[model samples]
Structures are given as structure tokens and as C-alpha cells.
Target: DVKVTQSSRYLVKRTGEKVFLECVQDMDHENMFWYRQDPGLGLRLIYFSYDVKMKEKGDIPEGYSVSREKKERFSLILESASTNQTSMYLCASSFPMGLALDSSTDTQYFGPGTRLTVL
Candidate 1:
């Protein structure tokens, strides 16, 4: 079974602080993604990594960055956190896209999420 875990379930930060969100997957998936979920905007991809040390910016990546130095671990960094960046951050993992023989293999397993509050 695939399992994903986030470093925190809830966090509080002040404006302009550097924040690091960590995620880990036990399934050895080849792809990992970071998303921020807002009330009406839904899940917006912040960053995704297809392999170790390889990252691609997603829809909203201006204030965020990612690292995937190890296969099982991925980290999301908020360089200078701001109040506007407060949201529920999610971490997900899945097998490499298009390589799944069945639809189930392509499913992304998500963590419980870290709700960050920037004040």
C-alpha cells in the first residue's frame, strides 16, 4: 500500500518567515507534487518533481520552490512567507505518468495536508 505523510497537520507563521514543508512517500513513486488548496480556487499546483533533483514549476510557483534530493522525500520551501500564501498545503505522490498499465496505478496518494496560517 502507498502511504504519504506530511511533517505537520497545522502550522502558524509570521509574515516574511522562511518555511519548509516536508513530505515523504513509502511507495517509492517516481513523481511527487505540491499543491495549495484554497477555499474557492481549489487545488493549485505549486511544484512537481518527476525524479530526484528534477523539478518543474506548476501553475503558481512564484513564491515557492521544491526539492527532491531523495526518491522518497520531497520538500516545499516558501522563501519569504506572506499572508497571501496562507493555505492548506498538500503533498501527493504517484507513479510516473503514462507508465501505468491500469488506472489505479496512476492514482496519486495524498497526505493529510498542512494548514498554514500566515499572520
Candidate 2:
């Protein structure tokens, strides 16, 4: 089974601090993503990396960045943490779904998520 783990389950930091959230997957997946969930804003993708040293900006990437130095590891960095950035951050990994439209193969396994609170 593919397992994803995060560096922290809950994090608390003051404003203007730098925060790093790490994610590791047991399976060698081609795509990894980071998303933040808020009360009504829903799950907004922050960043994703399809290959080592390659990354793409998602819907909301203003205060976020991502790194994929290794196949199974991805890191999400908050340049300057702020109170408005407080949310539940999720990490997901999925195999490279080819042309086949099977949704099963396109499924992404998610980690427990890290709840970050910036004060």
C-alpha cells in the first residue's frame, strides 16, 4: 500500500516566520501535490511537482513554494507565515496516470495532513 507521511500533524508559529512542511511517500509516484483547506474557501492547490527538480504552480501559490529533490519526498515552504495562511495542509501522491481514463489509477493517496496556525 502507498503510504504518505507529513512532518507534523499540528504546527503553531508566529507571523513572519518561515515554516517548512515535509511529505514523504512510500511508493514511487510521479506526481505529488500540496493543498490547503479552509472553512469556506475549500481545498486550494498550492503547488505540485511531477518530477525531481520540476514543479508547477497551482491555484494559490502566492505565499507558497515546493521542492522535489527526491522521487518520494516533497517539501512545502511558506516564505513568510501569516495569520491568513493558517489552514489544514494536505499532501497527496499518485502514480502517473497515462492516457487510460481509469479514475482508479488516477486516484491520489493523501496524508493525515498538517494543521498550521500562524498567530
Candidate 3:
């Protein structure tokens, strides 16, 4: 079974602080993603990595960055936290798209999420 875990379930941060959100997957998936969920905006992808050390900016990546130095771990970095960046941050992992014959293999397994509040 695929399992994803976040470093924190809830977090409080002050404005302009550097925030690091850590995620680890036990499934050895090749793709990992970070997203922010908000009330009306839904899940907005912040970043994604296809392989170790390879990252791509997603829909909303202005204030966010990602690092995937190891296959099982991915990290999301908020360079300078702000109130507008507060949201439920989700970490997900999945097999590389089209790598498996079954489409289900491409489905992402998500973590419990870290709700970050920036004051």
C-alpha cells in the first residue's frame, strides 16, 4: 500500500518567516506533488517533481519552491511566509504517468495535510 506522511498536521507561523514543509512516501513513487487547498480556490498545485533533483513549477509557484533530493522525500519551501500563503498544504505521490499498464497506478496518494496559518 502507498503511504504518504507530512511532517506536521498543523502549523502556525509569523509573517516573513521561512517555512519548510516536509513529506515522505513509502511507495517509492517517481512523481511527487505539492498543493495548497483553499475554501473556494480548491487545490492549486504549487510544485511537482518527476525525479530526484528535477522540479517543475505548477499553477501557483510564485512564493513557493520544491526540493526532491531523495526519491522518498520531497520538501516544499516558502521563502518568506505571508498571510496570503496560509492554506492546507497537501503532499502527494504517484507512479510516473503511463509507466504502468493500469491507469490506477497513476493515481496520487495524498498525505493527511498540514494546515498552515500565517499570522
lDDT of 1 at 88: 99
Candidate 2: residue 79 lDDT (0-100): 88
**How does each model score on lDDT?**
0.95, 0.92, 0.95
C-alpha-based local distance difference test score of model 2: 0.92
Q: Write the per-residue lDDT of candidate 1 for residues 15-38, one digit (tens) a residue.
A: 999999999999888999999999
Ranking of models by TM-score: 3, 1, 2
Q: Is candidate 2 or candidate 3 better by TM-score?
A: 3
Please name the candidate that would achieve the greatest TM-score relative to the true structure. 3
User: How many Å off is the CA of 99 in candidate 2?
Assistant: 8.3
For every model shown, the clashing-pair count is 0, 0, 0
Worst 10-residue lDDT window, candidate 3: 97-106
Clashing pairs in 1: none
What is candidate 1's CA lDDT for residue 101? 64
